[model samples]
Target: MKKTAYITGGSKGIGLGIAEALLKDGVNVAITARTQNDLNEAEKHLKTIGDAEVLVIKSDVRNLADEENAIQQVVDKWGQLDYCIANAGVGKFSSIDEMSEEDWNAVIDINVTGVFNTVKSAIPALKKSKGYIFTIASLAGTNYFEKGAAYNASKFAIVGFSQAIMLDLRSYDIKVTTIMPGSVATYFNGHTPTAADAWKIQPEDIGQMVVDLVHMNPRTLPSKVEVRPAVPPSARK
Candidate 1:
């Protein structure tokens, strides 16, 4: 039987990319996102990948019940889940003074709490399969920047949360990894990816990285990985 994976926020960008990669490798994938339209579109694209079965679920990761339902949906369809990616996240970049309460809460609720839900809900199945977990974080988790108070706080929380869980979950022979990417060329932060963003890390790069981790030796665990473009704008000058 082909391995099955569950990915949150898998309708687009890095999440979708990872699902596509895993699908191509003969891994059945179940993707969850808030919007049905995005999920439908993603499912269509994912079908072009390979023979792996694709399941698209409409779910919001911020809700624990929703997360649990999403995971249960995957398990119901596939019988077992071999991977869980807590990749649902949002960003609201603003200085402390300018950021609104709603923006702050939205970021924290989705980026931090959402991940907690995703991982927590998937733990039972993951333990059963001794699967892998990937938390898609950002460089802001470690490197703070101006006008990034909300986004920074959320990412930082996720990084710490993911690492702590890595230690907690490792005893079950389940691997956990947090991937912090610098300036990936995606729809993240409402930016339209174009040729101009080519220099930045591509979503597929991160996707392939996850695939590689899945294939790595069980004894070797790269718990935290920070990836950036080889030639950033600063370096190009």
Candidate 2:
């Protein structure tokens, strides 16, 4: 039987890229996002890529019920799910004094709590299938900087949470990995990806990394991965 995967925030950027890669590998995929139009667009593009089936679901990861329904939908359409990616997140950059409570809540709620909701809802299926879980964290999770209070705190929590779950889930034969990346060339943080952004990591690059992880030997698990651009703008001559 073909394996199945679920990806949150799958309409574009890293999530879409991961969907494409998995489809190409003959994995049936169900992608979810908050926007119906974006899901529709991503569904159209995904259909063109691989022979495996594509299902687009409109959902918000912050809502546990929504994630539960989305996972049920995937199981209804496909018998088994082999992977679940908690990739829906947002970044709010500001210092402690300048950051508003609303902004802080949004970041923590979506980035941290959203991930918790996704994995919590998917745990049953993942345990049954001995599936894999990928939490898309960031280098900022470990390395903090100026003007990064909210984003940094959220990511740091994600890294810690993902690691703890890895230990908790491993006993059930489920694999959990946290991918921390830096300077990805995507629409993240409202920045447009143009030619000038070519030097940064591309979404597909992260997708390819996921593929590699999937194919890795079952005995060896890379619990956490840190990836970044080889030559950042600061390093360019």
Candidate 3:
């Protein structure tokens, strides 16, 4: 029997890439996004990849009830969840003085709280299967930048939260990993991904890493991975 993976925000970008990688490896996958249209599109695209069972769930991780429902749906279909990638995140870049409370809350709700909800909802099933949990953070989580107050805060909180959970769940044989990537060429923050941005990380790179991590021996847990461009634009210039 193939292992199962549940990925949040799996409709596009990094989440989708990871889902594709898992499917290619014969892992059953359940992906969630906020829009049904995106979910349908992802389902269609994923079907072309491999024979693994695919489930597309319309979900907003910011809502606890929705998170619970998404997890339940995956469990009902697959019977058990062997891995979860909390890849759903949002960003609003603005200086602290200009950042609205709404903007800050929105970032925090989806990045930090959303992850919490995903992990909490899946803990029981994960515990049973000794599953892995991967959280997609950012370099901004550790390196502060101008006009990145909201995004930085959320990512930083995610790093701290995931570390604590790693310790908390280790006894249960559940492995938690925090993946922090630098800039990637994705349609994030209103910018469309393009070939010009190829120098940056690709969603599939992160996805592949997740697959490798999942297959690693149980005794070796690589709990933190920081990925960045081998040579950044400034270096090229």
lDDT of each: 0.92, 0.94, 0.92
lDDT of 3 by residue, 117-180 (tens): 9999999999999889999999988999999988999999999999999999999999999999
Query: How well is each residue in 173-204 modelled by candidate 2, as lDDT tens digits?
Result: 99999999999988898988999988989999
Clashing residue pairs, backbone N/CA/C < 3 A, model 1: none
Query: Candidate 3 has which clashing residue pairs, if any?
Result: none
Looking at candidate 2, the ten consecutive residues that score lowest on lDDT are: 73-82
lDDT of 1 at 159: 91
Candidate 2: count of backbone clashes, pairs at least 3 residues apart or interchain: 0
Error of 2 at 21 (Å): 0.6
Candidate 3: where are CA atoms >4 Å away? none
Error of 1 at 192 (Å): 0.5
Candidate 1 segments whose C-alpha is farther than 4 A from its true place = none
Candidates in order, TM-scores: namely 0.98, 0.99, 0.98
Q: How well does model 2 score by local distance difference test?
A: 0.94
